[model samples]
Target: MHYCPYCGSLVIEEEKYCMKCGKELPSDFDERVTSSKSKWKWWKYPIIISLVIALFITVLFVRTQQQENDAQELYQQAEEMALIGDYQTSKEYIEQALDHKNNFPTAKAVLDFLKIAIESKNTINDIDALAKNQNYEEALDKLTAIENNISGFKGDLINKLNTTVSDYRNNILYQQAEHKLTNDLSKDELKELLWEVEEITDEKAEVIKEAIQEKIVAHTSNHATELLKENQFNQAMLVVEDGLIYAEESEQLQSLKTTVEKEKIAFETAQEERIEQALTIYEQEDEINRNQAVEVLNVNASVSTNEITVTGEIKSVATVPINSILVSYQLKNNDTQILENDVYVFPETLYPDEKGKFEFTHFNKEIKNNDLTAEVTKITWFID
Candidate 1:
């Protein structure tokens, strides 16, 4: 008998190689195989069984370690996403990790945290969207809810959200106030809107309020200017008075008021000059013929309760018949100021040396002077 040295398989002595192991045998292989088999016989089967069991345990341990590693990887991914505020995606990864390893404690804990974080994050996102759409009232309500519900939230994120909501609220108010200012609104209505703007605490609110004030001043000044151009001085002053109530420090309104006052003075002066001219033209004797025309005499004034009557007589001093006669007279107060002045015409032919009586009566309530004077200012006659 022989044995192959590589495998210790028994073979016949004539064979060069062992058939079972396909290995060549050495001379004296049987002696060596006999010695080696006796040395291994007591422990071979037990060692083989122990090695198979160790291999099986090693494979199971490796598979378990791999599963744990895979779950840890998923958890790490979830953690990374959570740090950057992507809680929804982080939640998905956390759920996948728990599915991969049902007993993963870290994954289960993170999933619970992620659920709360996702809810809070979604609420904040919804608030931001509402603010972007200029729905500040609704956004504020949502923000208040989030604040009440989520305690110990991220401070920096909450502060940022607060700033966004505040800015959106201010912008909406500013836009509304700006729209009202641009329109043709009354002073009271504009002031009411301006009061709303003044109550806002935003940094830009002051600037917007100033702009609206300027618009108000400009509108008032322009409106007053139009009235001034139309010679409506009293109405223009009223406009300035109303505008000053709103914009007391407005230079435009003040300046416009000054201009209107000057215009009023100039207008009154022109009116007084015109009245003086009319009275002075009648006082001149060059416009009347005192010899050939009828002469006015015996002028007398009588005042009653409701009327004042001025009676006079006119006689043709020339030896010719006058076709038409006119008598211009002026009524003066005790201060010699002309109160009422008019001309009266007789539509009759007066024969030579004929006398005609004339009377002028006026309502006493219409005369605002304390005394009255009747005098012939001018007379006209027809020459044959």
Candidate 2:
């Protein structure tokens, strides 16, 4: 195969100018190609058709031998180009070798390999830029893509390319993981890096893995402790679980897990006792309020997009008129108590067999209380 004198890019024998550089080719260059291929003289062709026919079989054999030699020589040139990392030129040479002898398995393998090699080199360069920017995940994804692209083709360049790619991938993983693990990262971020490097069994990777494990234990333990202090038992337990995932055998994490469980149980027990005491007090107050001969009745509540309205009537069951009344109420949402407050019914007075109406409304964008209830807890009144 011919190449451009100016640019070293592929060119054809018949072209007067280089396609890549647009420079005029040497005129003798065309003459050399012509002289090489045209061995039959025009004057000799006029000798006899009979003589030409007689020599056809012998000439055909010699020309086939010469073509085979040319094919082998071109294949050698392709191999040399590949060795020097000029993959584009290597591919061109091997392709021309195949054109000289299309069925050459060795040349075909080299050509396929060169194409993949060139592509991988370009992709690796892009990965370098990405790694420089600390775009580690994207670089890792590209590494996977290149490995998959190799597709197990057989060639002399295959083992060399595989080794190069594998080394590059490992270096990327190691350097990035080391940098991240050495710095402060969230539990989730460290876990991601740990998972990425799990496939690497080398000693440098192990050091990184160890750093990640230590960080998980320390960071997660502290995080969980803060959550536990805030009385967020479930959230604390989740943080503990996150630590345990990376360092299942870590004594710190295991002890922390046990502490979380014990504290959660203890907290639950204390809460249960508090709730029980509160309920007992509520029931006693409710009984006392019921005996006082005042009762809440005809309670109705409605909710709008921005407001919750509760309106109810209060009745006096006593034999006398009552005035200056204030009632304590429990506000509930979805059967769970939310708040408590005191309100005075309108008119502040109810005669025997008479009633007073009360209403409460709250407007807040954040409260989506679709199922709200207002229940009376305590009532104070003066008999008149």
| Best model per TM-score | 2
Q: Write one digit per residue (lDDT tens) for candidate 1, span 177-206.
A: 766666777767777888878756788897
Candidate 2, 1-384: lDDT as tens digits: 665555555668788898788988777764334331233443356676768876997799888878889999998998888877788998988888888888798888777778888998999999999989989889989988888888677555666677777887888888888777667788788888889888775668878888889887889989999998998888988888878878988998888888889999999999999999999977775554446668778766677887767777888877666787887777788888777777788787777778888777767724564777778878788764
RMSD of 2: 28.4
* TM-score for each candidate, following the candidate numbering: 0.37, 0.46
